[model samples]
Target: MTPGMQIRLWLRQASKTQVGVTAVALAGVVVLLVASLTTGGHHRASTSVAAGAGAATNTGQGALAPATPEGGTGTAPVAGGTSGAAAVVSAPTTGGAAAVPGAGGTTAATAAGGTTGATGQTAGPLTASDRGVTPTTVKIGFLIANVGGLDQGGFALGLRTDIGQAIDAFVDDANKHGGMAGRKVVAVKRTEDPTNQGDLKAACDYMLRDQQVFGVVDSASNIYAATQRCYTIDNKTPLAHVYALSADFMTAGGGYDMTTTPNLDRIAKFVGAAAKQMGFVKGGEHVGIFTDACEPSNTVIRKVMAPAFKADGAATVDIAQTDCDPQAQTSQVPNAVLQMKTKNVDRMFMATSFVGVQNFLTNADAQQFHPKYFASDYDGMAADLFTKNFPPTQWDRTQGISSGYSGWLRAGHGLTPAQKRCSDILVAHGLPAMKDDAANGEVISQCDAFLNIMVPAAKAAGANLTRAGWAQASQRLGHVDVAGFQSCTYAPGKYSCGDSYASVEWRKEFQGYIQISGYRPANA
Candidate 1:
């Protein structure tokens, strides 16, 4: 039988008990095939996505090398190595332009009017700017999670809502400030069930083909890399910001990521260094890694994290894997915790979804096995979630890494000017008295990208803007201070922007995670 037929037969043979397992296995096979095809046998050292922070690979050390200049082809040595850099050729400034080669030797300029210049040797400026742009308005699309949908699962719906509101507020503020290049900024919003591939593809198609948006800004989703492959890769539509963990988005080469989370390697190094500093790894504590099988990024992170912990003097390394399906995870958590307890894991690292973390914690608490927990921002260990679900005793033992400047707004931990501005904008947009939470941070992050990165790049692209022009303009943004929150940079070959993060620990008195260390670059 053919491989496809075999897969179908195997799927059919799977009992109800094995359905989730079979589905996860099939998904893995599909991802591996896609990765092989997309990478073209030229795999980068790491698989951390460009722009957004959280999914990481081994960076060797904490510090990243300087970015490649606009005209250079050398890749940036950021958190994820050479693959972190997406090659971006400089747009012609003087006479005309040339059709640059995109990923897989595809013509970078396929849209109408994106032809060669008068010289025929070089491509010309964009003329047919009708897609998502007009003399008075520029349309952008937003793809975010459907909070009230059936697939909400473990995602923090409040955070997604805050991000959506922040986008609205940013667009309103931009229009008030003369808009982007004399056109009012308008956002078209779409919600998707993140776990549903059909929903994600439909959303992408609607935004790119039907809405004809100039660009897309996607919030956190597990399947964002797949969406990029299905839509943006062939269409050449630039994605403004993505908060997913997959590194393929950067290496595939098309858009930019505004992520603050360093690559997995950097995260691993950070965890090791932080644990050592915090006395958890002094005499080599037993370390365990918990990961979700469904999220590909988590798999990459778990592989790197274990070795890094060992290199940093972990006494023993144990691993417990679980599925991302809520029901399956609920059943798996007790067994996973039991294994960890039996192994006497003193310090454990989690590379799973926020929901997965909650399940593990709930089970751990029941078993009275209180081990120190380490995680990255992607795990959704926000202060609010901890306060609501976990007791002070449970949360106080949790330490995680974050790319933001401050913890969720606390009384003594004042907000930076940019953060305050984000809060004010949210209030003005009718989200009054928004509490300090992960959602608030999500808002600030997206707003910072809109204000500091996307708007500036759009302005730089000048009149008669096209998707290609927007991307070229984005490439020119070498390094920029993001409203005092963090620093971001891009170049001809680099798309992973932020290169630093801070270590935070949960504090009961403050009711949130507090920054224990100052903002440190990936390189120690």
Candidate 2:
């Protein structure tokens, strides 16, 4: 039996459920939210983020005026912008970028501690702007993970507060340095219940409609595609997402929505590449891929992942699906295990979310099946979701590829320039500097998106700060200084600027995951 099999079984019980509420309804039965979240409640006014905020509870001022879902929802990524991607920006910048000040003449430190800007292109907004931009303030929305009534303990205590402090501290630091386009960033904050689609849409609407934010920054909280659409598509606002955005969000966003992490296709592509690079999956091995039956997940499994494994020379590839049902996910695990075992799958990629990963890991062990696992940060593998559920084991031959940086992985190498700057800002605000992946690296992500990404992109927008200009300006940034990756590059359809993915491994000694290899390029 695995070391964590006992505890994993305990946590997998029905009593404790952060797996998220039913995302879809079938014949009056509730299911989904493994993806494909449901929005099936009675039509009510868009309430604020006070209803059942998760671990990161919302600190709402007041409920905004109720509104209805608007028409004209759209989709695609940088790699589809609002306009055609081909016409937007140049190809991505390769290798290290030299020091060039980000917009507003603010300097950014490179990996080697030298100063540089995200891009060298001299870009300034060409049109007049008035929406959410002011001479003194650039209002943006922050969607927080505020799970109402959940007892969030351990390093996750005050989850929302920590992120708030991290964001606020960065905002203060940015203002002190040279505000975006010479305008102070006034962030409009909203917390949402990640489990509830209604709350997700309401929170999104409040920010774009009531608060009139320039763009929405949500590094925490993974809600339904419809809610994401409410921002990037229906609202026609730019969004900086932590998770992968599907074609639904991207096409509707018209290239307005992007993840700070690698995109869906890039994630699957790199996982296969990383596994092969790590020798975890060798040529001719029968590989099994377990994924949720939802957009982005299943879509990439067929279009990106399976082909990737085959390209890596796998003899055969077996794809399995989880129906986004909490009960079905666990109940079907043994059968899935049977399939993998029967197929002699010794290399597997588990792309399921929190509950799915936890259940499968335990079941695979109980069934006497052990396969080297390849995962991504998107699986919530690096989050607190992993910390409490299980510990690393021999079977945890678990390795991952991610575009985002986590300080927990900065053991022998110390802090990167991006992490150091974020820590310093936190310390400046009387908050203890983050020394590890406490809060799973959410602080670093928020800092990266808000300070490094948004600040420069907004500045590139010049005196005007329209949504389209910001999206274009951000996508065009050739290279950027970010928290964890080797290089950060951007192009029209490639909205996220991660130029490389760092190979990480779950090390028992560190009690966390670490970067085991140097940077690997997206195209590599």
Candidate 3:
């Protein structure tokens, strides 16, 4: 019998007492794991280091109120003023514009072309003069993963912190460079649990309703769509870099995704292209698809990628669904591997997390089975376990489809100007610099959204900025160029910035991945 069969027989022959004890232990472990995953880990609220003269005030409940609006500096208060009272002057009801009370009870009017504030300055409809904007500051909130109760053990610990730091660093740099349109952007940080939908909603409520930020940005989490219900559906808050979740979040009236991480359908196309490149398009190749049912996006991967591969000439396409939780993946991966072995699959596509990928690779190695592996960006092909734990021989046969450029990969080829800018900002803020795939990817993705997308949208919005104005500005964007990466575009109806991808190959020597193909249209 094969090694896999031998292990299976041994597991079957185990005594009832031993099996019962092991099952009990696993149940207890899962309980502890679930408790940790569901609870909010750590909570912190602070003003961005770059707040400078217009530093934010920490309100109760981890909310940070915008800095005081300065007069004559062209800064205007919100319609209700700082006290949140009713406006002294009402907005225009007729064709002839009526003046409304602005910051500090200043009169402002919305005109045909733009908005005119108390200072008689006619700026674009979306400018620093709008809500959360002062001549010297613009307030934004960040709901990111950080500080779990356990000692750096939660999903949001290291990776989320790195992303937050990158955002802070970029804001600081922008402040030093005269800020966005002369308004220093202050980032109010709030910790969140990615696995807890309730926590995610609470974070959104605190940021949008309580804090009253001008706009929200960098809410990176696994269950990010849950937060969208609070911001997009309920509150209509303008969010930036909202591209990390499935396409279900991008309903007509739900929320807008401003970054170019392809939706499920686009990702399926990417996978299909990679499969063809890996010689899996031949009629005789048998393919196995592994998905984590716990992840909403995985449903699309299983349903969409399978058919795409089959149509590309995969003789037989078998799919396996598994739990994504790390502990559950431990047992699920082994059984899935056994099934794959039974079918003698020549290629395997993974729609799961790094943990599931690692476990399957371990079992495959033990069984002496080597198959061409395909995975989406969800696997995070960084220098983590795939480099330190998994054998290099296995990596050599692996291929990844990335929706965005990997900073670690770019750094290996020597930091581009954009990469250098990110590093410089991190160093300037006295934060730990990006060194690994997780850190680099987090920093790069956040910075790309902030600098390339958010900044430009704000600039286009002009000085009369409102949340609605910002959303309109983002929709008008087209062919936006990202430094050290591909260009993106945005339009009405379609919120995805760039529908392109880069085919990457695993390089054990670098302990990361390298792009074998430059950015191209996803369908191409």
Candidate 4:
């Protein structure tokens, strides 16, 4: 599809609300998963979407990688099967800018390798508490996609009522609760065209340079690597972003940028470990790995995948790389299917986007070869579209690891205490309670951007209140908790929030994904 078409398709439909339409959905790309949390690790990154119900799950801004991976900044990679400029991840995908967490492994020149002190402590210009801190309040900026022009298909994105009010609701509640370290939390929000460089640059300038907020909460904006660098690296600011992250991106962030969920680079490890524990990959099972041939993805084969499964007594493993070209990425699926059938492969690791996974499954079925499919839900695997649209023949009885988004979430079940508070907070703020709304994930994610990560970290920063202090203090959260999520673990070097993921399988009769297992360490 043309990039514009891809963007439009990514915009899923949602019911409108009075405040505005809180909608976002990728009703098309059905990456079979448990919510792979590429929603980045599910790969949709759970990117931010302004379409449909405001999906908060995969805005597909993880789609925000540059034309090519460069410098220190890493691609966002939203939902697994999500498509668009924001969530491309070097592979072809469908749907519009669903914040399908863009994929593509970029090398990081920053701190994953070398020990770093704190985020935003990199070499850069200095400002007072990263330029937006004050004694009485810490100014934080937020970047969200400007869906104004993208209001097609009758989905009127409620910029103010939904997005603005939702944010205000969170901010107001935080302040009422002693705020961040007893200081009122001030948030400045800016919207920019994710696909436009000028717009992105201007937005960054306004937030990073003009507003000089202490940090930024990035929802879904597949901005340039340089633009990202401007906010976190060069500008010495910090960001809590919702994108599928990688070690390289963490390095690019100078250890400053943090993904809301598990990172893409760790998907291999998470899936492998989760599979082994779930008995999906065990001794005597012939496993097949179908993945994109990219930097970190390629490395995942030997460095992460092999060891994870092999040590579990997997008899033999076959690896295949999907074509990386957006147009031809899945060209090899047929051959890969043939190989699976010929080799008697019984288990398959869908490391590529839902596009590639669906093709492989279709080709496999054509050959009457059905191997149990499992994945980490990246590249769109765990997206709502994946569960609803995926073929039951291919998706039924499959399971994987995910930190967030799944058939359960899509089914509008499983409300956590924290999620309940989100509703209450909204209602208290005089907004509609988004119970099963399409933008439910987006709104909740926005709340977590502060409630879960930024505010808590800022609180931990205490009076120091510098960007560096925020990064260092984040570890103070220790066993971080966020309802409806399996893991929100934090550590000094761990910039991503997801650590443990739950195992889930698809239920019959189109019930979508159901969790079969609880939290397990991704590194295990």
Q: How accurate locally is residue 263 in candidate 3, as Cα lDDT from 0 to 100?
A: 47
Please say which candidate is ahead in TM-score: 2 or 4. Answer: 2
lDDT (C-alpha) at residue 269 in model 4: 66
Model 1 lowest lDDT segment of ten: 1-10
User: What's the candidate order when arranged by decreasing TM-score?
Assistant: 2, 1, 4, 3
Q: TM-score winner among the candidates? A: 2
lDDT of predicted model 2:
0.54
Error of 1 at 418 (Å): 1.6
Across residues 114-136, which tens digit of lDDT does each residue of candidate 4 receive?
21223443432212344665444
Q: Tens-digit lDDT track for model 3 on 1-524?
A: 00100011111112334333433433311101000001012221110111111111111111111211100011111111011111222211111111212443211222233443323346554344566676545777655543232222222213434555566678777666645544557776665544344555556656665556776666244233334435654566666653433343444223234544444445566678766875656677888876554423443454456777877888778766554333445566677777787778888776554445656677789888788877555434422322334466676636665655543355356665666777778887888665543435546666766776676677666566566666767777777655324546666545554366666666667555667777667652
Error of 4 at 110 (Å): 37
| Native-to-model Cα distance after best TM-score fit, residue 280 in candidate 4, in Å | 1.8
Candidate models: Cα lDDT each: 0.50, 0.54, 0.49, 0.53
Ten contiguous residues with the weakest lDDT in model 3:
1-10
Q: Mark the regions of model 3 whose C-alpha exceeds 4 Å error after superposition.
A: 1-137, 147-166, 176-182, 252-255, 324-327, 381-388, 407-412, 427-438, 483-485
Global lDDT of model 1: 0.50
Instruction: Give lDDT tens digits, candidate 2, residues 25-104.
Output: 11111112223422212222111111111111111111111111111112122121111011211111111111223444
Mark the regions of model 4 whose C-alpha exceeds 4 Å error after superposition.
1-27, 30-129, 135-137, 146-161, 181-183, 192-202, 222-229, 251-255, 329-344, 383-385, 405-414, 437-439, 520-524
Count of clashing pairs, candidate 2: 31
